[model samples]
Target chain A: MRIVLMGTGNTATVLGRLMKKCGHELLQVYGRTSSSASALASELETNFVSTPGDITDGADIYIIAVSDNAIANLAGELKLGNHLLVHTAGAVSKRVLQKASRNYGVLYPLQSLRKEMDDIPPIPFLVDGNTSEDLTLLYDFAKSISNQVAKADDELRLHYHLAAVLSNNFSNHLYTLAEEYCKAKQADFRLLLPLIQQLCLRMNRYSPSTLQTGPALRGDSATIELHLKLLEHMPGIKNLYTSITKSIQDHYRRTDN
Target chain B: MRIVLMGTGNTATVLGRLMKKCGHELLQVYGRTSSSASALASELETNFVSTPGDITDGADIYIIAVSDNAIANLAGELKLGNHLLVHTAGAVSKRVLQKASRNYGVLYPLQSLRKEMDDIPPIPFLVDGNTSEDLTLLYDFAKSISNQVAKADDELRLHYHLAAVLSNNFSNHLYTLAEEYCKAKQADFRLLLPLIQQLCLRMNRYSPSTLQTGPALRGDSATIELHLKLLEHMPGIKNLYTSITKSIQDHYRRTDN
Candidate 1:
């Protein structure tokens, strides 16, 4: 299948490489800038196009892998004829690509991607389409490159995007905050790595709420007070600590009863 | 070294098993009730004692692995006669055991422990002692059962304990919330597991701040607003989403400059 890859960011580059590696024919690489388009095209052994009018026609599929804000604008600019067109975004609706072609859909990768990463992690693709035929096409294409692929409409994808933010983004922020706190107190942050890894391992087998541990879960007010006192100087972290602790306690109290 | 394990909780049982595996002599298991003490003692192939007066004396170390609230009261009942006494608590100070014996210290395991877990994860022991000799004894004892061992005083251990809560407990809470959200929406929560695992793997190499990616970090207000609307019915989750998104935006905004 001949594919036209759009955008040159992390998601774009990684997905483009994956599709190419899976034996998809890359007809052209498109980017807002000529340099980026040329770089990606060179890497994929394909032609480069920067202008909307210069985008090659009759590709089997055109994947618009730009940022959420840019997807609509880029889709409006593209002319994909009747070829299937898909945008790779979790939050954006597949309808965003409807104007670009008769067959439009989504190919959202539900994992973080970095072009510079040495190894590509497992990417679970959540797909949707304007039609059943196009959806099947996407399902097949996604399955070719990934073992994990599922159908999710815009609403479900948005829900997943929110969950991803909570589990991945917010959790990583907690880690960042913890590392900073460790550094401030002159404690070795690396020592916490094993604990973090163990938590991840436990999550695979048990519900996280069942595995919850710490002063917050134990409702140890003395320890909580000590932690609050320790964080007195750092208002932001302190507020976060207080808010999350309360949330945890409230959750269990409501659930346990 | 002959060891008298106190308490019959998760920490006590797991640590007792670890010590026994490392070839330490388990003299007895002490609990608040005879049945609980006998249960743990049977598991450890040791004797059981419920009354404080019945606790065997002259052990190399008397490990008080009870809850933080009970640590002080329990320590007061113990008669160690200069035998080393230690508590496996992260936030509690080594000084808490000083009243129990002439030689007192702490043997807090930084990792979360559960007696029911089939496979024990790496337990990093944080040792603190009142004297250099007691510290050496603890260092050797800890090194016997675990590869990762370090000396951290009360203040430092407390700091790490707080950080552990943030990274492990708080993060696990986020995961729980996310899983709940996924279940409510009928989206497969398991799909997000790869992303969570990838985040953990990335943490080993990069600082989490550098790895953060989301609508919040990207400052995409449109997507954030959509998520906020989606979470409107769930007040707790909505509040958390708003607070954490604001935090991510604020954190990077402040640091990026």
Candidate 2:
């Protein structure tokens, strides 16, 4: 499949590499910045372009892997004849690319990507297309790189994206706060790695609520109070701690009743 | 070393089994309920006792692996002559066991343990002892079961415990909330597992603050507003979503400034 990768950011770099690894013909790489576009294009052995107007038109798919805010504007600037156009965004609607092409879709990979990761795990691509034929094409393209591919419409994709935010973004922030707490108290942050790893591994076997353990889940008010006292210096963490505790407690209380 | 396992709950079962596996002589298992106590004791090929008064007097160490609230009271009930007494609790102070024995200490494992895990990972044991000589004995015992061991005082342990709460308990609650959202929206929750696993694995290489990604961290309020709108019916999740988004934004704002 001939493809054009339309960004040089994290998603673009990772996805472009995966496509090339799967023996797809990456025709060109385009980005607002010439340096990043040229760098990725060089690595993929593809041509490079600086602007959306300069993007070549003969590719089977034009994947716009830019920022969410940039997707619509970039899509509006490009006109990819009968070739499929797709945006690799979670929150953005597939219709946003309709202005750019007759055949537009979404290729949302539900993962927080890092360009430097040597071994990207099997990513689950949630795909959507303007038509049945286009959807089949996208699924085949997705299957070429990943075994985990499924059809997800705009509405369901958004909800899954929201869940991704909770699972990936919010959870990573909590790790940031945990690292800060450990550093402040002369405790090794690495000590928490086994616990964190085990917690995620347990999710595979048990429902998270069933595996939940802590002062908040146990309703130990005394320990909760102590944790609040411990976070007195960091108001942001304190507020987060308090709110999440209340949410967890409230959820369990409602479920029990 | 002869050891007495006090309490037959999750921690006791797992830790007792680990100690026995490491070739330590588990002298007795003590708990309020004879059934649970005998069950674990039988597994460890040790005697069982229903009360603290019946706890064997000659063990080198008595590990009180009960709930945090029960630790102080349980420690007070047991009088172990000059033998070392330790409680496997993060938030509780080692001093709580001073009444039970002159050589009282702490052997807190900073991990979310489940009794059913056949192969336990090397757990990080945060040890605290009243005396240097006593600390050596505890360290040696900890080394038998785990390669990771460190001396963390009460205040430090509390901070580490606070960090663990954020990393493990609070994060697991977010997963629960995410799973709830997925179930409500008819999206497969299993699809989110790879993303979750990759996020934590990224933590091993990057500080979470640096690895953080999402609409919130990107300062994408349009997407945030849409998510908030989508979460309108689930007020508990909505509030959590709003507060965490604000916190992530605030963190980046501070770091950038």
Model 1 Cα lDDT, one tens digit per residue, B1-257: 89999999999999999989889999999999999999999999999999999987768889999988899999988777799999998888888778779999999898988988897789998999999999999999999999999999998899989999999999999999999999999999899999999999888898887898888888888888988999988988888888888788778878889
Flag clash pairs in model 2: none
TM-score, candidate 2, first chain: 0.95
Model 1 over residues A152-207: C-alpha lDDT tens digits? 99999999999999999999999999988998999888889889988888887888
CA lDDT of B204 in candidate 1? 84
Query: What's the lDDT for all of these models?
Result: 0.90, 0.89
DockQ of each: 0.79, 0.86
Considering only the true interface residues, what is the Cα RMSD of candidate 1 after superposition? 0.9
Candidate 2: regions farther than 4 A off: A51-54
Evaluate model 2 with DockQ and give the value. Answer: 0.86
Model 1 CA RMSD to the hidden true structure, in angstroms: 1.9
